[model samples]
Target: MTALFDVILPVFLVVGFGYLVCWRKWLTEVAVDGVMRFAQNFALPVLLFSAIARLDLGANYNPLLLLAFYCGAILSFLLGVALARYWLKRPIEDAIAIGFVCLFSNSLLLGVPITERAYGAEALVGNFTIISIHSPLLYTFGITAMEFARAQGQNLPLGRVALRALSGVLHTPLVIGILCGFAMNLMGLAGLVMPDGFWAAVTMMSSAALPAALFGLGGILYRYRPEGEMRAIALCCFGSLLLHPAVTFGLGKLFALSIAEMRSAVVTAAMPPGVNAYLFAALYGVAKRVSASAVLVATGLSILTVWFWLGALP
Candidate 1:
């Protein structure tokens, strides 16, 4: 109960607040869109870089932990695709979108802070490891799948595809921020004594990122209405809100993660679909409605699902 109120409640309250503002027309769609970009392009990257750079990961980092979490996530993504295409009979593009919503979690906006509350601040190192790679990996896999599904052909030019994917990733602020953090860590600059202003600015950005993201997420959700294959949306929400976490739990145990790591893993896996899932679907010119609906549905349902996982965690 404390876990629920301490972490989960605050996140949702901000989301609800965003919904209220939009409903009241106190903030226009244009205003919310600007906030969205700010949260995405600036605040989140700063927050991620600051967290990753400060932590002394040393012996705390675990390769097997990443392997387990990603394996489960990829498996869940594939399962969503299969269900959408085979059972729901959605088109290839929609199927790819379904896979993405299932794979991508709202780890940044709702994840990092909540996990810190659930486990402890040290849990952030584990959280950063997941956040740092989650986007780039998902982008590569989802983009490759979309391109191949659209144009099935000779050899598929995977090297070219990978390069193209790398290019997109290079431009993203989140990835750049992470790279900067890693570079700082490698150069031992993370340990250098910095001015109070430097720390204060990082703290401000990091602190602002989550709440702004949540509010911006609410605005986006309220602004978009669901218009797609209902069956596909249902399957996507199911995969995201339920099955992904289940698979992650089994994999976390199989990888022999610590109690704290498993708690972080399971809690993170249970997060709702991210807004970027819809962004990708829109970018690829398919499944936008289904993606948007899944984001909304998974978020609404996650309140119950999150509680289940937090209680289930040790």
Candidate 2:
């Protein structure tokens, strides 16, 4: 309990501060959006690039751990799609957007900080390992599914659809950051070829990513109210908070992951849907309400669920 509070509450408090600022109108909506733009477009990409550039692939890229975490994530995405599309009767496009909310966890904002606080900074290699491919992989999967669904209605050729989807995924800032990092890592001799000043500048930008993201997320949440979509919201919360982590936990056990690996995978899997969920929905102009509400509600629910997972993880 104390440990959980110590690890989790501070992070929420930053989010709450952002919320309070927005609610009180202390900051203009434009200002909030500007902050978010900076965070998502600039700071976060730099952060990812820096982290991945520095990551030791051989030391941290555990195949089993990746399998456990990502399998759970993909499973949650599939289940979310089924629930939203079939049970909830959302349109296929809307279902894919909602499923993306389940697919993309708050890995950087919530997962990294919470894991660092709970376990220690040394345990973050696994978290970074997962994060390295997370956005690129999931966004590719989501975009391909979404584009093919749209193509069915538009009578577009499969080649064009595939090309369009690939174009969309490659154009995203996060994916660009990951690709650049991989390029640097592979070609630059694991980032050793970079000058100290270059890394220093990257570090400077990286420092602003999380706080700006959280604050901007709070401001965005202020705009999205939970009007209808109650069932969908509940489904999203269930998929993100409970289902994802449970799958990861089971897989970690089956894989015989170490305590640190289990902790990183399960804790990260337990995070709420990130602000990117809303962004993704907004990008497609589908299920924006459900995705935003899921990000807000699941984040609130995670305060307890995360504690439960913390206790439950061995």
Candidate 3:
């Protein structure tokens, strides 16, 4: 019970603050834009790098657990696509956005903070592993899904799409940060500690990233309400809130993960629709409305859903 409050409530508080600010016009879109730009371009990359750099990627790491997490994400994503297509009868582009929303979670902003509070810093390694896998999937398969939707009966430039997607992966600061961190870890260079001033600067900036991103998400939500898109948002939220977590929990149990790991996986799975879904929609020029709707609804609902799941975890 205490864990629920400790781990989950603070996230809601920050988001609520952001929402209020935006709703009251306390923070203009320009301000929100600037903050988001900073988060995406600077703070997030540092956070990713720090998390990856700190992982001890040797023998004790659990490959099976990693596989289970990846498989669960994939299955849930496909399930989302199916539901959007058959039940919602949405266009392919909208359906793809729905699917992407369900699959891609805000593991960084919400998941990492909650899990670290609940389990401890050691859990960051598993979280990082999931993000690493998710990043490539987001760039390649996820982007392709959007492109397919956007192609809209027209022939897709397969080679061009592939190249563009690969280029996106290459240019992502977060991905580059991860690669650098991994290289440092692999080369046994992580031991070379930075000077105190540099380390302090990194820590300070990384610490600010999550809250700023969450607040920016709230600002986005404020900018875009989900009133008209309720049906699609509901479906996407259900997949993210109920089905994904349920499946992940079951997989964790089947794989005999520790209680902590199971809890972590469940929380990770239950994260809200990622902000990246909207970014991808804009990039692919498909179903931007649906993507925006998913982001707003999922994020708004996740506060309660996360608290409930955390309460049930013991």
Task: Tell me each candidate's TM-score.
Answer: 0.94, 0.95, 0.90
Off by over 4 Å in 3: 148-158, 189-197
Better of 2 and 3 by TM-score: 2
- Backbone Cα, N, C clashes tallied per candidate: 0, 0, 0
Q: Model 3 misses residue 29 by how many Å?
A: 1.0
Please give the lDDT score for candidate 1.
0.82
Model 2 weakest lDDT span, ten residues long? 187-196
What is candidate 3's CA lDDT for residue 218? 73
Encode model 1's per-residue lDDT on 73-154: one tens digit a residue: 8887999889988988888788888899889888888777678777778777777877778887888788878777776755
Off by over 4 Å in 1: 154-156, 189-196
Error of 1 at 136 (Å): 1.4
Best by lDDT: 2
The lDDT values for all models are 0.82, 0.89, 0.77
Can you write out model 3's per-residue Cα lDDT over 141-250, one digit (the tens) per residue?
A: 78776655566667878887677668777787778877876776665554666567966887999998998987876777787756546777777788788778877877
Clashing pairs in 1: none
Model 1: how far is 313 from its true place, Å?
0.3
Top candidate by TM-score? 2
